[model samples]
Target: MNLKDFKAKLKNKIWRNVKAYFYDQRIADSTLVQNINLSTAQNQKKAIVSYVTYSHFNDWENNNIGRTQPFEILSMVKVLTELNYAIDIVGCHDLKTLDYLKLKNYDLIFGFGETFYQLTMLHPNAKSILYMTEHHPNFTKIEEQKRLDYFYDRKKKKANTVRTGNFYWDHHMKKKYTHVITMSETEPFNTEYTKPFNIFPTGILNNNFKLKPKNHDSSKKHFLWFGSYGAIHKGLDLLFDVFQKHDDIVLHVAGFYKDDRQLLEFPNKKNIIDYEYIDIQSNQFLEIIETCTYCILPSCSEGFSTAITTTMRHGLIPIVMENTGFNRLNELAFFLNDFNIEYIDKQLKEYSTKDSEYLASLSEKVFSFANSNFSIHAFESKFNVILNQILKND
Candidate 1:
């Protein structure tokens, strides 16, 4: 083996040993691990097993971090149970539990990304489906990583680790899975069966999120950039550069920075306000959306953007890139062809010049699109259609 590979293996071995030593104690205290158990009561349909945390099923408990719990995982389990199928759910991290379960008995298996590998082990006959969340190498990985490296000041080692993990999962680990469900047509999923589920993943937004009769005076010329970490990945640096130059539109940032130094790097531009780390459940998060006319996210890549959908539900027009996982955003929102300051500046200027009536109309369209596309009802209906097909498949 090469010296680099040897060193990596050695480091991983040490890390694994440390993890194994604390595994039992940590597992005992983990809510996700504790909830990983076989379903009670037998049903009529073929047994179905899936890899998903039990906490994801609880709407109240969902933190909406990384847009992970787009829909309740248990909702799918409950549907299978209602259809008289026996269900078994295990935490995605509980690899050892696979040894205890009768893997061959399951007629169907559903999992996300790499979990499909473990789900398919010793069960070649079972139908398997992978929920595609990101595009892998040779598709958009090079471009995506290049953008991230340029924009985000993350450590090289950390970036390499993520790139390697994603590459291995999407390329090698996912090969055995036959089916894939994706949020966008452009996202590449190398599998025998691929289905494009176009709607962006829905979050906690409900009918209440629609800010009715939005006060045009206050909301006009206000924009928001809200997302979790990976500041460079989401193009926060590009945003800072543009927003600093143009004082016409007020930009509010609602996200956690990877480092305090990243925040300190940006000087106090008058038009920019930073409310670091706004919780989705908090009034501050809602108020930002209620008062903002547009939400901007020039992300390098995304499976689906929860922030964009959440903002849209609150009647905020989106200004994002094509690869941000919302296809045909030009219909109801501004689509950024490039993150260059010159192009963004020109677009911002155009938006600044738009009349309130036109902006209000766009806001209505945004709200309509979000409500129809990202609602729980929409997810449930679409999920049922897909699940029904899978259950009946030969």
Candidate 2:
């Protein structure tokens, strides 16, 4: 056999073996997730919240982060009921960390979190909104390193090493479900069984967050580079070196990170400020991001990130790598040739010189775009229609 074919076969075999190991270990956890779901599904048709960890006040307890979604789900359930639709949440299998409610009555199930696989057996009679939040590499012949990075061996795809069970089960359910929703990902499983799958705007902190005023020097400029570290495929290494060389402009960070070797790495600069996290919906959050003149997302892979949406909403000139998720953003944003700080500095300085019209235009284009397609009202309305379909079919 050719070397390439041999390599590909070897990778898949290794992946299969790892998946098998996790399958055996996670069976108990999956059962617990299932048992909880079965209990929640004991009733007839009623409106349900099909998402996960609505009660997690922090980013950790919940796999997904941003603004509150459970409340949004609750509100949507109300809207469904007004339209005479029955709703019940198939909260997947997170009864332990999930906020339990008296949801004995509902029409179908919704898959919002990590626990969806368990509901597959119990909720076949129910409809589901399959919202997957994990990043996976799709090719059976993925590189050895990529597979290891995605945690396929442990059944967990990156992030926490906990609860690796049901990777294959999740895939089967992901394909079988009538309705599926996902953000961008490293690996996407677009199969005939998933034809009904659609992409939707990520839900953010409900009406609790408003545009608070955040005035910056506007004259001076700062740049941002961000993403979750565990998913470094987001491309920080690609950009960091060039950023260090300039030492003139400021670099702001968001998402999770920790670097003590930082002192040794770029001991020369006083411009980099690591806030660790600025809660996306907090008033403080808007102000800090506003202080910067640019938003940088060096992502290798993505689903249309809400961060990008947020940057545009506030008029930060997003400097993103071309042909990535930032493809359509050319009209409203700028591009960098690479992670070269020289290129980044040139673009930032040129854009920073523009008057309010430029910023206004940037903000206007994004505001108009967001209103047209990504407004919360739009997300709720779209999901509501999908729910109706699930009801008809279920």
Please estimate how well model 2 matches the true structure, expressed as its whole-model Cα lDDT: 0.51
Q: TM-score for model 1? A: 0.78
RMSD of 2: 12.8
Residues 108-220, model 2: lDDT tens digits: 55555444444544445655555644333232113224423533333343333211222323354444665665543322545434444344454343234344433434623
In model 1, pairs of residues that clash are none
The model with the greatest TM-score is 1
C-alpha lDDT (0 to 100) for residue 188 of candidate 1: 58
* Alpha-carbon RMSD, each predicted model: 7.2, 12.8
Q: How far is candidate 1 from the true structure (C-alpha RMSD, Å)?
A: 7.2
Deviation in Å, model 2, residue 245 alpha carbon = 1.1
